[model samples]
Target: MTDEMLMMAVKNGDLEKASELFDRYHKPLYNFFVKITFDRDLGHDLTQNVFLRMIKYRASFRQDKQFRPWIYQMARNIYADHFRRNKMLFSDYAEVEDLKNKIAAVDEVMVEDERQKLLYISLFKLQPEQREILILTRFQQMKYEEVAQVLDCSVANVKVKVHRAIKQLREKFLELEKI
Candidate 1:
């Protein structure tokens, strides 16, 4: 069944279908949280929360809408709530030593290459908004239209943000390479 069908089943009280959705989305959602927060344990928790929220707020699910963007919107809200509750500034959270420790704990496959490690380090260095846009558009491979829905912005705005983020990432990656 398609994700939308599974989600529709979930919304209609056939809760067992949620497991199929979970099976499909857990890894990508986990990786999304890990990439954003640099904390594997927290990623696991937040990803679980997304599914829980979906079940709790099932009534809000509109059958006319695509499931992927809707779930992503929920994930973004959950992440925002987490950020607000922690009251952490990006500078405070992105400490070099702390990031290195967290990144070291990330899955080996994601960090096996030296260049890939450097790229992630660069990603972590970006402003939170820039980092998120890149993760959503590039890493998650969400199309511009889906990203626009997830972000509640225009496709043109998403494109502009992506372009600027790539430029920033490139500069950060180059700076990291020099060190």
Candidate 2:
């Protein structure tokens, strides 16, 4: 069944349909959280929380709306709220260290690649908003319209944000390469 159909069934109290939606989306959502937070454990927790909220707020699901963007919007809101409540700054020194360690663990050869390492460091150095925009548009391959829905902004604004983010990422990558 389509995600929207599953979600609609879920909204109407067919709780089992929610599991199918979760099964379909959990991996992508987990990856999304990991890319943004750079913490695997936290990503797992946040991903679970997203599904929980999906059920709790099932009635709010609009049948006409696309499910991916709606779920992504929920995840974003949950992540933002958790960040704010914990007073945790994204890309802080400790988190950056964690990200570096995780990257190193994933592949020693990746760490050996100077450009790859620099790109990762530069990506983490970006402001959360910029990093998020890039992750959604570039990494997740979300179209501008879907991203606009997730971000609650116009398509034109998403285009501007993505252009600016790419420019900033290029600048940061160059700066890091110099060091």
Candidate 3:
């Protein structure tokens, strides 16, 4: 069944259908959380919390809306709430050993792994807003319109944010390469 169909079912009190939505979205949502938080355990918790909130707020979902953007909007709000609660700052860089393990395991792609490590390092160095825009648009492969919905901003604003974030990411990546 389509996600919207399933979600609507959930909204209508067919709570069993929520499992289907969870099965479909858990991994993507987990990866989204992990990428932004850099904490897999927190990702798992946050992902679970999303479904819980979905069920709790099911009545708020509108049939006119698309599920993807709706869910992402919830995710962004959850992440922001967590950020505010923690009152923490992003690290300048993740530890090299930790990043190495997170990036790859294949010996044959050692070179590629190095590149990915640098990319993630650069990503972590960005301001949180810049990092989030890049993660939503580039890593999560969300379109500008979808991101605009998730961020509650104009599509044009999303485009501008993405452009500036990419430019900053490229600069950080190049600077990392020199070290």
| lDDT of every predicted structure (CA atoms) | 0.87, 0.85, 0.81
Q: List the residue pairs that clash in candidate 3.
A: none
Highest lDDT, which number? 1
Task: Please tell me which model should have the higher lDDT, number 1 or number 2.
Answer: 1
Please give, for residues 23-118, the per-residue lDDT of candidate 1 as tens digits. 989998998888888777888999999999999999899889999999999998998888778777432355678866766665454687777788
Arrange candidates by TM-score, descending: 1, 2, 3
TM-score of each: 0.91, 0.86, 0.85
Error of 3 at 53 (Å): 0.6
Number of the candidate with higher TM-score, 1 or 2? 1
How would you encode candidate 3's per-residue C-alpha lDDT over 3-77 as one tens digit per residue? 999999999999999999999988889988877766678888999999999999999999999999999889878
lDDT of 3 at 158: 97
| The best candidate in terms of TM-score | 1
Clashes of 2: 0
Q: Which stretches of candidate 1 lie over 4 Å from their true place?
A: 89-110
Worst 10 residues of 3 by lDDT: 102-111
